[model samples]
Target: MSRKKYILIFFVIILLCLSLVSYSNTTIGRVLRFGPANANDYLEFPYHEISTTSTYFKFGEANLENIVKSRFYDVTYGNNQKVGDLDQFLEDTDTTSFIVIYKDNIIYEKYYNNYNRESIVTSFSISKSFTSALIGIAIDEGYIKSVYDPITDYLPELKKRDPRFSNIKIIDLLHMSSGVSYKEPPDDIYTYFAPDLRKLALEKTQVVEDPGNSFLYNNYNPLFLGMIIERSTGKTVSEYLEEKIWKPIGMEFDGSWSIDANDFEKMESGINCRAIDFAKFGRLYLRKGNWNGKQIISTGWSVASTAPYGPENNEYYPNIPIFKEYPGYYSLMWWGIRRDDKNYDFYAAGNHGQYIYVSPEKNLIIVRNGISYGKGMESEDMSWWPIIFYQFANQFPSE
Candidate 1:
């Protein structure tokens, strides 16, 4: 044999060895900060009755495939200029699906290379906001008494152990002001990847600030809230959500939940749904939890969740660390923005570019889904996409 051929074979053997080791070490499960068991092992909730039977919108017979492919609205001047150039945008950023909905109709929906509209995309932290909507529905149904009630009232297991949590109101969790000692932007990567996120969240031995006095963005707030919902309502968050929200809204696809080591739904980030289903959620919020005059989530609670409450005295929650430099607002699970002389725009955003942007004034909803696992700060900022989307919003000539 030739010496060159022998050297090439030796390099290939070494590469195979490294690949095998990497595959063996990596766990076969969804990545979570902390949890005892792999997420896939979690038990799924039984399918509930879909409320679409009585609703005017029919999914099974609709030409959904053709609808997604056709252009329903004229691109805005700004979007028009950038339409042909979106390849550069996608290349520069991690974008999976980009869609635009106007006046309860889909105008433009496109998936990335090797992706399609039917692909089930993970919502990351965007699921938190959806969970908030579920909580609102539970309140409307009288399953939950009120947001002011102590969490212990619903989940007695949390009482007496943590004094700070003793009086923590349900609203406080929604506001991300539970006074729990949590490090945002995570100081230690290993600690963030623990198996039991619930234990880590509540086990924080110290209370740095009084509950409701300060605002801190942490996953613990939502995860804890999910537990409270399940304990109070005697149903998993996914079960309650399907019955109360998804089925009613006529969501066409089945969504999955990310489970913890104990097989509990993570609730903070484990939501996965199709792009159209996500748009349906955006539309539901756009209608203030109403679908054709049917009250899905109480309109009053819907308004409250998206509206701001804080000492900042601003109509929207300010001082979120991720968007500190940017002019944005946080309300419950949604992010609000006030553009120059434009209407108040709010959205449900997740890490790595998952977004459900809604403009009530224009009756427009835009959903962008992406897979940005290790892109760092740029994914969190989402600075460029919003700017591009706002420009897209301007394209529709005012009626």
Candidate 2:
């Protein structure tokens, strides 16, 4: 071979090596390019080290008139309805922070492990609830005609890409019944990356079941739903959020959403925000989407989103150990833990125990952010969370 040809081949190999190194240094690459090395690490991270990420949109400041601080009582919670101190329970679960709101007042708040009001934690799948709210707002604005419309109506590109996309209602995505060919194991790499989400959106997978026929907590459902919202509104979710909900509702901090190396929003599990701001979002829904007397989201939409998709008996989840006793009642990317007729708890939950829990009957809102690390912690019966939160709410007598 000529000397010139040998040098050309050498340069090509050098360029490939350089590209691989550069990709590893990218934002998403730094955090996730190498991927999770263990199940616990994949599901949760220590509180102080939770802020690493890729691209994001910064929210502007909306000062809160009140940042009331309150002391927590000796709240009882955990397996077998065990009674214990709230602080101890929090420590065992590796809680980063916990906030309790009652009757529009901050009743109990605490930050642990160097986490404070200003410290932001990753929302994980709790962001799905935010995506769901955006959908409700879009529906009210007539950006999209109806939630029941087939998703292909908004994103024509998805038509005929795969048979699975056909006849899939927007509501099915909201209700996790699109049968979108997904499984959410704790160590699933798709849960933590943006590229994987986009790739899944376009993959041609076989249609395993009819849409609206069952429940499956697939990330693609919310990811595609967010895409539909962007298409209909001509805005990223963050831009629309600031205009419609964040500023009007009075969020005090500039929360952010994780974006991929390619700069697309993760859309499902990538939201990051101060713990207090998380409560405010819950408060908006608690007041039936009315903030400061403005109906930012329709009351009907809020009610329906929080309410169960159908009869409590019909809901079913994948046969996973963590969800051994899954609620039969799933709602629009939210869970209505139908403990009973009157005291059902509506909540937005994330992996490793992040939650925004709202119980309308008690006029209560609870936010628990955590690393939530331990052996088999992912499979723990988290339904106990609302039961204990209700117990905390009942500490104060009603009028």
Candidate 3:
């Protein structure tokens, strides 16, 4: 063989070996193969299945479905522009599934991109909200004494690493104000793909600010909460979720939560289930954590999670561009926007545009799942969704 041919063969062999090394099970391997995170990433990672109750609760169809299909309001430039067809706009935005519930009825539900009612989509950071709810349930069940309890009380090993850990309260984690040093590129990516998440959490968490002093939206907060839940409840977060919330409220389908190599649930993210089931979670919060007549989580917790705050609490909200124009707020992992009536509309948002939005006064709930955040009027930080939701909900006649 010629010298050039031999060199080419050698390089090709080396490339093949590297590809085989990262072909599966590792974060880099998945990213190289599947590209960035998407709505269907549940298939990429090992997960723990959360079984459903024998009896399931399903939303009833409204007399008139797709009631708000005419126009989509655009508030990009602070003006309402009646856009084109609503369905087409959703398609243009890469929406995989969109649902609307009013008066506990499925008023409008549509699936796109080969997705349907039975399709499974990943929750991304929306799982953080679920983690927050679990904390409230843990407290109610007496497994956890109180939110004021230092997290080290549950994960005492953290105190051994740093005595300052004793100062971080459970509420600090719930509020994303635990002062854990976190950055999106390295920290977020590392936690998402770390082979041993529990170790990374316990060893790598370094306090940058005093607890409850500022909001960083650190993913590590939920991760630590997952550890706390496991220690306090003597069950995995997935198990607690299945028993405390899922089965009790009658989730229609069995869900799953992603886990690391050691089998710890990735509490920062990784909930996977159907869009309708996602709406059920929204309904739970909308009705003040009550399912039918059963109180799943205390009404006080439900109210406090979504309630609005004054500008004084602005630091607690995500430091995003949209907050400059809209009084956007974050409380206990839930995002909110102050309405003109001084009421607040809250929602759970995740990466790549997963949302479970609820308006308490309107008795409305909306769920959105997407492959990617399709073309919108503004960036992800300055989303047009709040306006779209407000306009759509207002179209209905007064109760």
Best-fitting candidate, scored by lDDT = 3
lDDT minimum window of 10 residues, candidate 1: 38-47
What local distance difference test score does each model get? Answer: 0.65, 0.68, 0.83
Total colliding residue pairs, candidate 3: 0
- Greater lDDT among 2 and 3 belongs to 3
Worst 10 residues of 3 by lDDT: 71-80
lDDT (tens digit, per residue) of candidate 2 on 1-399 = 999999999999988876675466343453443454221332233111123224232232322213221123344444444434556656676778888777776666778766777776778888899888999999999999998898888766677686457689999898888876775553145545434455556553335788877777677777788778788999877777777776777776666666654445767777777888888889888888997678999999999889855634434565543234534356887876654655566888887678898878777788998876422234333445555555555554442
Q: Give stretches of model 2 more than 4 Å off.
A: 1-83, 184-187, 194-196, 204-206, 311-328, 373-383, 394-399
Candidate achieving the largest TM-score = 3
The TM-score of candidate 1 is 0.75
TM-scores for all candidates: the values are 0.75, 0.78, 0.92
**Number of backbone-clashing residue pairs for each candidate, in the order shown:** 8, 1, 0
Q: Model 1 has how many clashing residue pairs?
A: 8
- Residue pairs whose backbone atoms clash in candidate 1: 34-194, 34-195, 35-195, 35-196, 36-195, 36-261, 37-261, 76-395
lDDT for each residue of candidate 3 in 1-399, tens digit (9 for 90 to 100): 999999999999989977885776665764566556666678878999999978899888885553466524342323454546777777888889999998998878999988999999889988988998999988888999998999998998899999999999998887778988999787888788877889989998898778877767788988899999999999999999999988998899999999887999988789999999999999999999999999999998888877864336546556676566676767888988876665678999888778899887778899988887667545645767665776666666444
